[model samples]
Target: MDEVEVVVAHSERATLRVGDMFLKVDADQARIDAEVAAMALAPVPTPEVLWRKPHVLAMAALPGTTVGRLGGPSTGSPGAWAAAGAAIRKLHDAPLPPWPGPGRRPDELRRELDEECEALVTNGVLPADLVTRNRQVAEAALRPWTPAFTHGDLQIAHVFVEDDEVTGIIDWSEAGRGDALYDLATFTLGHEEHLDDVIAGYGTDVDLAVIQAWWALRSLLVVRWLIEHGFDPFTAGCEVDVLRSRM
Candidate 1:
């Protein structure tokens, strides 16, 4: 057997290059990759796709890795962040067909919260009361709004940066119609100082308070997930602190 070149590895999936083709796999996660590939190529004006073999193989590898060197000091430059913000704006502005299905409603999100709470309890990571409280706060905060197509897991790690510019955005499995500000909030929550630059780049007059609320809610959810999955809590806690400072 030959060793495949590993492109990226996450808790959910591992991307590897086998000969001329690329393969992505996880425990029963191939279906998700197929769905994401379909959505990404659905006249969305995103990165060009080369080829795909059902849910198992998808080819298109850009040169360069995510920003910030491994085990090194934070190299997330402000200029790079500004460029990424602009890239996000372009992505959001792209015309996407109305998402199918019932879409994300507040009631549905509340049910998801309940499910997350149960998962956290089963993992014994945090007090059940904490999860419930966080969910209640998030639900109440998100209730007064409509949803839109958003990159559900927008973060620095998902952005491919080279020479202070974003070459591409990888990982679309979490993309769906939810809230317009969801991605922005997720990106800017930890790096609050970059919010000004991102907002300026995005050139939107949306309510800052609402954006801040989203940031808080998203941070709480991220923390809950991290704890449940036994991941590091430091990063999520830092984001939560940033949101708290703004509040």
Candidate 2:
């Protein structure tokens, strides 16, 4: 019998790997549905869905390692990062998904950020100056944008590659119509060194300022959630460093 390896386990969801199969257990049916639908609609490679039962969805694992992970060195070459960027561009070019993405509403994001910022300052999780500076930087991202098909969480860990070729991207539950830059920003969050390579493959002019703003915005918004979920945002090359870099 194949031993089940826990890939990730948090309050919201847990993923397990048993041999070649990856099983995702999510409590939210809607999120699962969206993941399935997004995978079907995405132009890029995705895990092969085997079966789904209630809150559990089974899939065949893709054959490649992630390009990199936050707070860790990226083992992939520049070409691999560029390939991932090209794949992202393809997804963004595809027709918009039927459902709206979580990033579509900037006002809601502002409110959430405000709350989080207040909590961070009041609780002394981060110094007020750091929070204030990042908030100011984050404001640039809270503006109108032309919606595109987006992988709402395009963290480096979600993109898989082998030998400079993008094999697949995973974790599509947040996929929907949203700002394209958000995806770009998420992809290059901790791996800022690869931004140029990514932009080269993206094959279009990008707003560096907006992308920078997203780095701060995303880091700030997720720090608290990451802590609560047993993730260490303060790791040397992680979210806290990303925010500190803005200082």
Candidate 3:
């Protein structure tokens, strides 16, 4: 037998790769159920569920490299990004999942954003004006959206590519019904240069303003969580840069 490969070992959960299978162990049962349910309904390519228990879910490993890397260039060609965009379009066009959750309600987000901005400013993680400016910019994304099947955390790393095609999308934990542009923003965060490629592949004109707003809003919201988890958002080519870019 081969050694177990620790893919990600965060405080809340950990994923291990063992002999072509991935075992995801999470503490939150609801999140685990959401992941399983979302994967089962997504229209795009996803891992095959091998089995599951209360806290552990096993899935078949996917083939191919990710569409891009975080904080760096993607070795995948523009064609691959386009392919990923097309795949996302397919998913967005699918029927809504039964469990979309409380969702990002504007009132909740406004309050949450205010609190997160205060924390960032109060703790000096980011400058006060930077948070304020980004918060104002984030307002553009607060409008109501027609909910689509959204991969809540659609980073390029979650998309796998082979031969300029999307082999599969992984990490269905955040899958639900939400703003389509939010997923677009999440994927393009810190990688704005590739937005045109992804949009081209999406086969339609999209509202870039909403997507940009999401970039700011999402970055502001996640930095604190990243910090609490012992991750550095200010490191090169990461969330800090994404927030700063808005300034």
| Candidate that scores best on lDDT | 2
TM-score of each: 0.69, 0.97, 0.95
> Global lDDT for candidate 1?
0.59
For all candidates in order, the CA lDDT equals 0.59, 0.91, 0.86
Candidate closer to the true structure by TM-score (higher is better), 2 or 3: 2
Q: What pairs collide in candidate 1? A: none
Model 3 over residues 190-219: C-alpha lDDT tens digits?
888889999998888999888889999988
Candidate 1 lDDT at 236 equals 37
Summarize candidate 1's per-residue lDDT along 7-110 as a digit string, tens digits.
Answer: 66656666676654446565546545634644564333334455554445465555555654222234667677777777777667655535432235667666
TM-score of 2: 0.97
Of the candidates shown, which would achieve the greatest TM-score relative to the real structure? 2
> Between the candidate structures 2 and 3, which one is better when assessed by lDDT?
2
Q: List candidate 1 stretches off by more than 4 Å.
A: 1-11, 16-23, 26-50, 65-74, 101-103, 114-141, 144-147, 235-247
Q: Least lDDT summed over 10 consecutive residues: which range in candidate 2?
A: 97-106
RMSD of each: 4.7, 1.2, 1.5
